[model samples]
Target: MTELEYTTFGKTGLKVSKLGLGGAPLAGDFGITDEQEVQRMIHAAIDGGINFIDTAPLYGNGESERRIGQAIVDRRDRVVLATKAARSDMRYDYETTIRSVEMSLHRLQTDWIDILQIHDVESQPYELVVSETIPALEKLRQDGKIRFLGVTTRNLELLRKYMATEMFDSIQFYTRYMLLDHTAKDETIPLAKELNMGVINGSVLGMGILADAPAPFLREDIQADGLARMEQLAFLRKPGPKGLIEPAMRFSLGNPDVHVTLTGVSTLAALQTNMSYCDGNGLASEEVEKVYALFQEQPLFD
Candidate 1:
């Protein structure tokens, strides 16, 4: 058996590795994509002991879901497939959110979803979440369109506020070593556990930053927020250690209470490399020390 570890999704009986396959740029779903190459990577992750995969209808316009679905159709029963709806990137709310889930199921070719989330919940205000959003989420859950309903966002305050209502079964938040901003390393996670919510950590690599990436693919100078991360951050000034992608991934997988960490695998090599970290103790203390030193010397992304 592969060395990957498993945990239940929240209090549910759904068992998934601490590391789950994230389908994003790999699926090329947003526009033009390499379906064949992404498929190979998907299988590699499955074979490497990743039983959890997270995707969304908005990712590459449902491209990631379709590719992930096709890759694991035969093995669908073996995974906890999670996808999100209710994107704030558009004027979407309750009705459109339901439509998004339906479309995602059609694309994923699955009759039921293990986890269905409210995508980009923090991008909007709390009123939106309490109003058209939460009600619709409740509707979907009642309709049994999804086995569990959760919210995916980085807003700890908002998340805490929602959790106070005791409505969701799970949550998706961001947690990583390089996290300087929008990180829940403080108390959100502990509270989540106390509240009995499944916690899935997203952007585990900081969008390839921990991959010691040359800056998450540096597309263009769009929003001021992104422009700030353009290569000048102290944490990224010096390149990360020469280790493959495994060390960072393995570290995230070790966090207790983390049901899964979603990593976007771009290639077959990327998937294999990440699985290398699945062995639990992929690095010795000194090796981990070297990795930490590397982080200390660079600019941290918040």
Candidate 2:
């Protein structure tokens, strides 16, 4: 196998693998999971040079975090662990935020988190995030509970609010660099670059559409559109030295602003395939430009 690449997590001063393992699949979000198999996959990811793991309480109701904790108990220092705190109710107050962090810490079985992000900041009120949530996170940092603070959002306006506060060390957002959407590239990415914040690119596979998963397997809202887009992207998957996923992974990695690109896998084979793509050289600039040109005329989705 080729060597995996590593990069500095912007402003955090921690070196992270360019490809990080996402925790959703571990919780059986993709399908029914075998506990032992999940453990093996986590170990395989770490052994394969994945130094970062991201999870959240919303994923399978904390089962993901629990499995991760068990998988990395002895190897905690080897990976940078990150989890999110979801604002569960209308009461977006400091106590609620702190309680979420506390629960996350227990579930993760870690004394201190490498990164604790506010999950889906756009769902909560901006004033509450500014007045209560961020301050509570700051308090957690000061208390030696978390090393850094981050935020994840799909809302550009919410992202702007996060940037203005200058409290976030990183930002996680969905960017289908391989697909038609360029919202992240056109908006939040530049602002994050200016603030020197790390960028974690999620939904790199367009919720599995680029991977050619059947429409029945996709989310309800995107099934129709995703299937159509998959048809358009079928040419990239023709039997070749490099398949569609390779180019998709490479495209996201090619962006200088993207510090880490996340890929969620339910099986060992899927994990290995992603690792291979990370080890290989990214797509050539001209090839990337060609692909981009083909999708350039397509409508941008939210």
Candidate 3:
């Protein structure tokens, strides 16, 4: 077993594990999840030195937060709990924003969230996020409901737009920074580093594509592209228990620019496997250069 490494989260000065536990799988978004099993996995993750956990109301309609809250209520001090608002069952209005955070607090069983992010900001109107959504988060921060502000979006362009505002303490983007798509490293990641905002890289396994189980909701074109790319990178796969998963996990874990790489696992076994990759190992310098040369500026999704 390898010891987990910690990083200073951007300018926040919050010490976060290089690997964080993501909440979608626990919410049963990926498949059927057992409540007891999920709780146990949370405990194991914390015990294994994974301090940062990310979740959102969109994941199984708050089931993720509810379960996680119940699991960590007694050990909350050991984790940097993070959850999202505005993408739940309400509009992105001021009142709804406040209501959303309050609801998350209830589900999480915590008085205050370490990080409260504006979920999928690109899906909402920019003016709404700037005028109403942000103000609501600011109010929550002032009210001691959340300690820091962050934003999540798959749209790299929109992510940069929000990062430019300088209001957020962190930024999270998925899929774009994975093996099949290295587009984020081109600008989005550099911008976040330049602004000194914590960078959370989600979907490092390309939503299970790297694990040989692509998500059902992905487009046929994306699924095909990911599979093809996976085949091309077969040489990087070391003979091990996880095969491609090992390299996939290390790809993001090894990146100095990525502060936190989120691992979405439903079972204790999966959590343990991901935890094992946190041993300060990443792809070789030559392998990284080869991947960059292969993908270059080509993005997998439109």
Candidate 4:
């Protein structure tokens, strides 16, 4: 077993594992509901030297946080836990945001959250996040309820707007640094580095599309297109020393702008496979370029 690599989470100065455990799977989002299995996966991640765990209240309606609380009994201090707060209407309101954080705290069973993010900032008005939502989070930080504040979104325009404010300690977005897409490398990642905010890259595998697996979470039309694109990159699945996952995982981890790569795993096997690629070694530069050339002219979605 290779040792997992660790990095400083941007300006926060918190050392996080290069590969962090995404909490959606624990909520049984990926068709996993066995409590014992979820606990096993969480413990396995920690035992494997993965300390950064990111969860959100929207995942399975707080089931993810509840399971996380149960999993990290005496080991809470060893993990850097992160969770999100989102209004039921998917809008940003100060009162609802505050209440959401309180509920997250109770479910996580933690006095202070390591990182508290505003979920899906793109769905709400930017002024609301900047004027009301962020100020509310600042109060929580001052009250010592959350150590750091951040935001998660996949919308490029919204991300650019939030980065300009420089109010967040970290930012989570889809890097999509795979054979099919590499949009984050364009401007979002560059701006993140310039502002010195932690970059947590999600959807590194294109939400399972890069793995050539069917992702029922996606809409039918999007799923169909993803499967077609997967076929285009079928050469990567050929018998070799490395398969599609290695190159896909390494592509995101290889980027200097990415501090942590967030991957959601429902089973221990998937978690172990990902950990193997976080051993501080990524694909050679030329290999990465070759993979990118295959789909440089093609965009995964509209």
Winner by TM-score: 3
All models: lDDT? 0.69, 0.80, 0.90, 0.82
Question: In model 3, where do residues sit more than 4 Å from their true spots?
Answer: 240-242
In model 2, state the lDDT of residue 229.
62
Which regions of candidate 1 fall more than 4 Å away from where they truly are? 29-33, 175-182, 216-241, 282-302
Q: Could you give the candidate ranking by TM-score, starting with the highest?
A: 3, 4, 2, 1
RMSD of each: 4.7, 2.4, 1.2, 2.1
lDDT of 4 by residue, 1-302 (tens): 76999989989999999899998778877785788888999999998899999999888889999999989877999999999987446666888888899999999888999999888886788788888899889999999999998888877668888888888899997735556677667687888888999989887777777766656767788777766766766655636533577677887887777998987887888889899889888878877666666666455654
What value does the lDDT take at residue 243 in candidate 4?
52
lDDT tens digits by residue: candidate 1, 21-84: 8866756632355778888878878777888988887787777888888988888888889998
Which ten-residue region of model 2 has the weakest summed lDDT?
Answer: 293-302
Question: How far in Å is the alpha carbon of 140 misplaced in model 3?
Answer: 0.7
Give the C-alpha lDDT of model 3.
0.90
By TM-score, the better pick of 1 and 2 is 2
In model 3, the Cα lDDT at residue 224 comes to 91
Listed in order, each prediction's TM-score against the native is 0.81, 0.91, 0.97, 0.93
